[model samples]
Target: MKQRPFARLRAPRSLAAMATAGVMALALTACGGTTKDSASNSGSGDAGSGASASANPNAPIKEGLKIAFLPKQINNPYSTIVDKSGIDAAKEYKGEAKEVGPSDASASSQVSYINTLIQQRQDAILVAANDPNAVCGPLKQARSRGIKVIAYDSDTNPDCRDIFINQASSEEVGRSQVKLLSELMDGKGEFAVLSATANATNQNTWIKFMQEELKKPEYSGMKLVKIAYGDDDDQKSFQQTQGLLQAYPNLKGIIAPTTVGIAAAARYISGSKYKGKVVVTGLGTPNQMRQFIKDGTVTKFQLWNPKDLGYLSSYAAAALASGQITGAQGETLKAGRLGERTIGANGEIVLGPPFTFEKSNIDEFDF
Candidate 1:
């Protein structure tokens, strides 16, 4: 039996349920080639051209509209919180919404789900893509049929989606993690990044910034030793955490930018001899990391509210569907309780800064 909250933190995940859905998706996608080569960078496949659409800020939010959330994988704790909140937001706006995706974060697994969404004629498709380019073909087909594509949390390529609802700016999220680790390790030592999928757009983008941030004289004492991928699976992440420790005995810190990886790493460190010796910090849900903080496995970790991220994305999807604004730079739209947001260059809409959770304030948050 399963309980509420983050994936891999509570009871066994309902991976069996999601796998059944993913099989049908794969069947459908197999016909469409299900690979990055299925679509070319040339014009026809680069849909998400909302710039050509007109804006109407005064347009009333439509009712009974169908929107679907396609996460990197629905069987993830962080992604579950995000998609569930997005579904709830759709209800608030009088629209119908649901979440659908593969159980695994494999590169091509999400494409078939995108095809299903397109066939169902969803008014909007919100995706946190596994690979930025793998889903472009289906997304292009979706946009050609007048469906609004909004990339959230993890983005697709700019040409593949209309609006990207970023949890935080890529540079800030990446550089901040390095800065936090520097503070913990006193700016010196060897660390590694336990990431999700290697091709994960957001993960790679953030890691790039983290690498760049390290080049500055302020972080000369710190060296990034290795980057290990757990593919967003809890068991694999736990193993990767152990492997990292074995591979680098002098590793002073571990930065796991994915929620699954962070929780898994903290779980491993808490029960091992490395407890307290290796600092674990990165983007993680407060609920999942609460015990780690209390048990002294981790001193601090950071994340923007995933619920707020989904809520904001739902509204952004609705705004595009309702024609409130096109995905143009400087276009503005209401985001329910988050107030209004303006679209930035490249259709990016940032949620804001990350919040650090520590012993002092970790108990204040539930999810």
Candidate 2:
């Protein structure tokens, strides 16, 4: 139950807001709108700032507890898989859940949806934040109104959520990318990271570690010249990859730590003159990267199972709603099928570690 000194959750702090969403107030009429009865929200009491921060292992997951999944982008393949898994997991505990979000992965796009969820009075709202500060105010309002906020995949500002369901240790995810790229590039070359949104919490945290890792003497030969943001768009990321290659003709590698960015980078490199000359590696799904591996466009890449990330997050939401844990260090969470997991400092529950995929074994699994 002791907190590990190896890692500390990023301290809660205010940063400049990325953008603000216009707020609209609406009143729901049962005749044309959803009410509490119709929506099936059925949990309470421990969601406010004043709720008791204690764990009760025997508490039952409340029946009809309403939870919602708000991914960075509803249409994104990676977010789609993660959110669907959360929805299915909610059903296992008799909790009602629905997915809602903007089609674009933008900082302000998700704000209106969070406000809608608040108006609907859902029991919990699970989010994969696009920008930590942009969504902070709305999340605070949700929590103030007694809605449990659980952030998964990408985190919000630390103070905005009840607990964070981290897919893997942030530092490990970052350093691993540099390590993978080093081995692929023979520990010496010019490399640049093709990351997600510029304001993305998870992506930035991992990038920080990657920069730190590069300071090691073993990696003295490699240089990180730039960090480009794709905003998680397919076309833009493809263009970004092309631009990176043309701009840095001598660049030997690209690390894209986002699923969309990685796949897009691979797609561009596969058909271009850089196919065999540049090494592309980062986090991605097997289905998305399998073809690239087969064609030798990418020698190696890494990712944790996104489905497992969702399932674990859903169960953790259930635990918080059921009053089993209170987002405190040393508290234990019981995730169905995945078994029990302990909470660490700053209410973080890391799903596990990342896995590397290569030609010889890429065909063995699918997500």
Candidate 3:
């Protein structure tokens, strides 16, 4: 029996490494080193560097064909959903899909994990990068070693990966969360944003779009007083939330788009004396925010079903790895049980629309 490891895949770094190796292989193909072997070892630190790159792109994989699904954090519900999605896909594809990540979404830690997976010579990798550019170098090397790479939840440099499995349009995710906050505050009030790491691509993109959307006339009265970074640490998020309360005595609402930040903030608010005075809104798990919603600490919050996100991400990765979709714009692919997904111009696969959670329907979910 082939044993699977606990750690997830590292797609961005692996893809980046592959690209770098491809360039070097092209130059060294005539110098005794085979293009196939050099390409496979580009980013992967694996000793097996002489594999044929000309092997069928959609070759039949085996039961032990390893595919890693690395997220920002393994314990967070948001990332857990992504991990589960990849897991489900691996099961269907007759292979191993493992989940691994840094404890606090550290870029350096992610790079280290990528190096380890390359050394293992895993078949493929799927990742949600912490720092986009930082992961690219390692990913390029993984690609050089002939390992398929897929980016899901967040992207890396396009040249580094075969496909990027987007949960939803980044613009849509940003607009949706901001729209939820607008509704919670009735489009008028002093609101603050509690975001994740300052360098996180997904959060920054959403925040930028939210800021842009707020500038429109409809949200003219909604003042975004401050933006705080929690680094996705629970204690830090709690401290930041408490600070926000003290710093903005007149603040009416708080929007925390990152799962860890929002849940930590919600816990602080729910346990505080000022619970009813302020509204908490953002992306969170139904299970984590259930009590807050019931006690009126947070009237409502929003998040898409994470299990579904994971399930779809896995399918997208497998399809791309197997050459089912060419990772081209304007393409479409089928997601088992979830129906068909459209491939946008940037090689992104939109899973579906985002879903919201409130007191009225919070009990329907467990994670």
> How high is the CA lDDT of each candidate model?
0.84, 0.82, 0.70
lDDT of 2 at 138: 85
Q: How do the residues 1-367 of candidate 3 rate in per-residue lDDT, one tens digit apiece?
A: 2112111222234311111101110010113222235533433443112122222334443455677777876666667655765575678768777776677777656887777777766677788878777788878777767676778777877767766877667888888777888887788889899998877777888899998889789898899999999988899999999999999998988889888888898889888877887888888877778888888888877766566667777776666555455566665666666677777776677665666777766765566
Candidate 3 versus truth, CA RMSD in Å, comes to 10.7
Model 2 steric clash pairs: none
| Per-residue lDDT of candidate 2, residues 282-347 (tens digit) | 999888898999989998888876777888899988888778887888889788867889989988
Score every model by TM-score: 0.88, 0.88, 0.82
Model 1's alpha-carbon lDDT is 0.84
Provide the lowest-lDDT 10-residue window in model 2: 15-24
Question: What is the full ranking by TM-score, best candidate first?
Answer: 1, 2, 3
Task: Please say which candidate is ahead in lDDT: 2 or 3.
Answer: 2
**Every candidate's CA RMSD:** 7.4, 8.9, 10.7
> Which stretches of model 3 miss by more than 4 angstroms?
1-63
Q: Which ranges in model 2 have alpha carbons more than 4 Å from their true place?
A: 1-51
Evaluated with lDDT, which candidate comes out highest? 1
